[model samples]
Target: MNRTPEDRIVELGLVLPDVVSPAGSFQPSVKSGPYVYTSGQLPIVNGKLVMTGKLGQTVTTQQAAELAAICALNALAAVRAEVRELSRVRRIVKVVGFVTSVPDYSDQPAVVNGAGDLLTEIFGRAGTHARSAIGVVALPRNAPVELELIAEIAD
Candidate 1:
């Protein structure tokens, strides 16, 4: 039997949270033609940020990585809200992650792997995509990590 992406997420002991409401003036996700683009997602759970602080200072790398995963899950939620089904996703085209870190921190790639790895685990080969992990001085809400995704969907 074949499993859907949502099933795979459940198998991994992960549940997609409700889509985080936009903090400013943008939609959480927008579908254009055959693609869906998600706004940057933070690790907010139940209306509160899971963690806040710089990656190399008040937050540990491991914690930041987990937060990155949470951000990815939130991104997925936004996609689902727009597309209405995970099965519509044909390919995860791209991922961009941002990590708020102290000046000495340079392990942004490793931190973002948490999101990349989870997407691959859920969607298998379709999850493979180009990605960028960037470290910055700060992020909105002082979040440790943020993530956004672009996915190709079937009409």
Candidate 2:
């Protein structure tokens, strides 16, 4: 039997967390046609932000990268909440990551790679997608990293 995406996630020693409630009026994810778009997800676990601070300052690059992975995981949870099954995903279309950084920090790509690598590990080739990593002065709830995803789903 083929290993499902959830199984791959489990094999990697990660459990997808429950879909987080929207902080504001916006929905966590929306499905349109064959696509599902997730709102930007913070590095929150168990209803709390896991880490906060500006990268290259209180938060190191490595730490921010790990937080980015958590944000990706949350984004996946949002996707699953909408589609009701990970196996329904046809492919990850795109990823947009935001990193809060101190002045002069320029390693945003490496930080967001934490998410990209995890997606590839779980979904194999389908996980590969176009991506944008942006650096900002701050983010909602003071999260160091946030991630959003666009995925294509099967009919």
Candidate 3:
């Protein structure tokens, strides 16, 4: 909570993208009290999906990891839009990452780490938080990963 999140973003060379409108009825994020909850974010870079396939089948773990990072970035973008100030974040509360994978694949944690690690690099310890890396039967648009986040904001 020492170094500001804006400074952290700069340290990590990350700039939040504009929060894209939800493809459906849901909002990108909702703020309650000092916390912001972001909707699940798909890995869309430059407004295009990088790849699409179930992990351990047509997709490699490395690619899935990268996709997860993009999801995290998207989640942050939503947070910025919802709260109007990334620097107001005191710390990341938690992350829920979902992966589309083959039945035999059990590397969901590593894939989600792509997002978790980026948070650490960007916010240092303030980014550290509880998390769940889940493997699901499938994801929307067959994305390799989807990420959602909860963050605590400063008054």
Query: Best lDDT goes to which candidate?
Result: 2
In model 2, how large is the Cα lDDT of residue 127? 95
Q: Count the backbone clashes (under 3 Å) in each candidate.
A: 0, 0, 0
Candidate 1: Cα lDDT at 48: 98
lDDT of 3 by residue, 1-155 (tens): 56666677777776677786788999999999989999999998777777888999998888888888889889998988877777777899999999999999999999999999988887778899999999999988888899999999888
True-structure RMSD for candidate 1: 0.8
The residue-by-residue lDDT of candidate 2 on 29-77, one tens digit each, is: 9999999999999999999999889988899889988998898889999
Q: Which stretches of candidate 1 lie over 4 Å from their true place?
A: none
Lowest-scoring 10 consecutive residues by lDDT in candidate 2? 60-69
Candidate 3 deviation (Cα RMSD): 1.8
TM-score of each: 0.97, 0.98, 0.93
lDDT of all predictions: 0.93, 0.93, 0.88
- Deviation from native of the Cα of residue 105 in model 3, angstroms: 0.2
| lDDT measured at residue 69 in model 1 versus the true structure, 0 to 100 | 90
List the candidate numbers ranked by TM-score, top first. Answer: 2, 1, 3
lDDT of 2: 0.93
